[model samples]
Target: MRNPLSDKVISIEPSGIRKFFDIVSEMKDAISLGVGEPDFDTPWHIRDEGIYSLEKGRTFYTSNAGLKELKVEICKYLKRRVGLDYDYNLETLVTVGGSEAIDLALRAMINPGDEVLIPQPSYVSYLPCTVLADGVPVVIELKAENQFKLTRQELLDGITPKTKILILPFPNNPTGAIMTREELKEIVEVVIEKDIFVITDEIYSELSYSGNHVSIAEFPGMKERTILINGFSKAYAMTGWRLGYAVGPKEIIEQMIKIHQFAIMCAPTTSQYAAVEALKNGDEDVAAMREAYDQRRRFLVNAFKEMKLECFEPFGAFYVFPCIREFGMTSDEFATRLLKEEKVAVVPGTAFGSCGEGFLRISYAYSLENLKLALERINRFVERLRAEKCN
Candidate 1:
């Protein structure tokens, strides 16, 4: 048989976070802080809604754009939470997950050789999805000094004639960074000046610890040019439900819906129903979960500080990016040694991008008990490394 894999597909790397997770899975008594998933179960009310839908025989596929009721709920939620108004009929698309919405958005907008500027360290999917869409992925290395927030200068530097899309991954995954409204205005100015489009991934929007999450789509002249992707996974602990939505200009949403119609048909009907309940009646559930994550976030940051590790205080998301450069080892080496010696798993920063070197992303989505135990093991490992260096 001939070599049959597409070169583009062959060239793409698997997610770095998953690699460590697989190793941790087989190890006995291992504690994994590698994955970004929430530890909380789908809230009872949300799960009950899905169960109710199934019991009522609503298992059939919804319209390709999604159930009208679900879309309305999504719009209402966006308006109530993010302060943005969207047309449920013409400007929204339901997707398999936030991941699929991102892929579809790139597919809908990217032409061959179009450049998509992606900020790092971010979620693992953006670069691969951009490549699969036949777009060039240009990475903007965000600095820890800036709290991993993208700067206007970096945005300006990354733009070129071929640049067509800028991915704003805020309330970032591995680094837990968020861009303030003032910071976004500066970026919006650059985007408008350069005449480029943006795909803002705000899946973690509800998890912002500093304040209410702000969407760039709320800025003047941005809603027309920005594709906003969000879902219930992070917020409602519905990761397995695989429901997400994209809201943007009608022109863009129509194209995304076309791709979604043919490729996915529609999101899971039960999930859509569950999501409706989540949007309508799950605010208290979301608030309660956010509070738990906030507590864990503070605990992990303080733990890292007490260990004398240089950790940037992350105000959003459930992960902490702590610098391990003081140990005179690469991030991958440190993570590997810690996992092997202490049975504690964390993802190396390089998993997100090269700029993540010398850092490790420890997810605090686990319980306080798990986090405390993991931190104890991590502190011990660090001290052992120090003692070895002295010896």
Candidate 2:
């Protein structure tokens, strides 16, 4: 018998984030701040739309590119909310989720051995998708001194002759760092000169604090070079519905659509109907969630500060990455100790990148009550560690 496995499949480790989630599942009394998902249920109105679709017997496939009205509404929402103007016909491709959009965009454009520039301490999918797409992932680490924002210098440093794509995941995950318009302008200058393609994952755009979210599409000469990925999941608490969309240059989007068509014919029929409702009627729900999340974000930051654990205040996503070096433990060790001793679940920052070694990421997506309890548990854990140090 042959020991058969694809060489590409052999090189990657299983997802680090999944390991902790699985562990927490078996442990009773675990309070998990590890998962990246929103705690809110899918809003009643949105759920009702899907249920209504089924009763109407509209249970067939949508157009492979997705419903025309949904794509039109996506264009309108982007313009109204985020200042990104996209063409519904020529520039957009509806995907199964932002995950599949990432995969399809990479598959459509990546030639083998081409380098894909990704900022570290980002969502985990980008690296693995780059590898699976037969593209080389060159990670540029985002730094604490920079508030985990990727600098233009860092962007330039990662580029070489073979570099083909740059993924911009602002209003970022894990670190919660967001880039400003001036910062994005600095990056756009280099990217335009190099003629490099960009994949901008703006799924968390609505959840931003301090300012309205800006899009790379707003930059001069960038709409042609940028692929914009946003979805129903993060913004509308619709993760389980599995709907996302991408918009970019027609040539690129058309190629992605080809890949999407062959692999998956259409997004879910009910999800398409529900997503249309979300884009239409769900803005209020999003605003309410963002308001609640901002409070949790404030609470989590103060908890870290009270413990004397150094942390940069996060601006966008519902996570805080706090330095754990004071504990004199590796990120994994700190995480393991927290889970075992206090029954609290937080992700090791190293799960995001090599540079995340001295940190831990805690999600603020839970309710105020659960967050209060988690913080109390964290306080008790930290006090015990201090007493142990004194002894």
Candidate 3:
């Protein structure tokens, strides 16, 4: 038998987060704050619309570009929520999820061996997708002391003539750091000077605690060069629906559509209909969820403070990355021991990147009772680590 695996695909590591999840799932009394998804169900009104659409026999393949209605609604939603505007007719394309939008953007942009600058301790997909597209991933480590935000100098240092794309993973995963307009402006200056094409993953845009999100697209000369990736998953509790979208220049959208048309004919049709309703009437759902998450965010941050773990308060996403270096354990060893010894499931920070070593990513998407229990167990576990070190 011949092995026909693509070396590029086989070389990449599997999602580090899910491996621990499988082991933790079998534990009798485990509390999982490992996965990065909202605990809320998709809102009733939106779910009803999907059921209605199915009952009405709206089950055929939508246009390769997606339903016109959904794109129009996305246009309206982005403008209302993020203060970033895109022309629905020409600039937007619905995707299977933010994942597909990311792949499509990379495939549409990268030539073989072109370098894509990716900030570390961010999402897992960006680096793999770049490799699969035959693009080289140039990793830029966004450090904790810098609030996990990529600095302008780091961006400038990584650019070369071969640099073809930059994936801006902010309101970031695992760390939850976001850039204010002024902060993004510093990077924007370098972007404009080098004319770097950007893919900004704003999936967590609606979850920001301190203030509103500011899109790089809103910055001068950026709209034409930035592809904005957002979706119904995190914001609307619709992860299973698999509905997300990308908005950018029409030329790029058309190119991405060609790749999407061949690889995936369309995003699921019913999800698109539900998404239209979500766009129209889901602000309240987002606000309510954000408020609850803010409470959990505060609770968990305070827990870490009480435990004396070194961590920065997250701004947007439902995750808190706490440094466990004081425990004298690698992230994997600490997370593994915690799961078996105390039965609390949190992802190792190293799952995000090498820079994520010596930390753990704890999501706050569980019930208050569950969160409290996990916090108690985590505190005990940390004390145990300290006690072990003393011996």
In order, what lDDT does every prediction score? 0.94, 0.91, 0.91
| TM-score computed on alpha carbons, candidate 2 | 0.98
Q: Estimate each model's TM-score.
A: 0.99, 0.98, 0.98
Candidate with best TM-score? 1
TM-score of predicted model 3?
A: 0.98
Q: In model 3, how large is the Cα lDDT of residue 209? A: 95
How many backbone clashes are present in model 2? 0
- 116-180 per-residue lDDT for model 1 (tens digits): 99999999999999999999999999998999999999999999999999999999988999999
Compute the lDDT of residue 325 as modeled in candidate 1: 92
* lDDT value, candidate 1, whole model: 0.94
Badly placed stretches (over 4 Å) of model 1 are none
Q: Which scores greater on TM-score, model 1 or model 3?
A: 1
Clash totals, every prediction: 0, 0, 0
lDDT of 1 at 351: 94
Question: Residue pairs in steric clash, candidate 3?
Answer: none
lDDT of 3 by residue, 1-391 (tens): 9998988778999999998889887879888999988899999999999999999999999989899999999988888766777888789999999999999999999999899999989899988999899999999988889989989999999999998788999899989899988889999999889878999999999889988888888988999999999999999999999989999999999999999999999999999999999989988998999999999999999999999998899998899999999877899998989999999988988888999998889999878889999999999988887888899
lDDT of 2 by residue, 19-61 (tens): 7889989999989999988999999999999999999998998
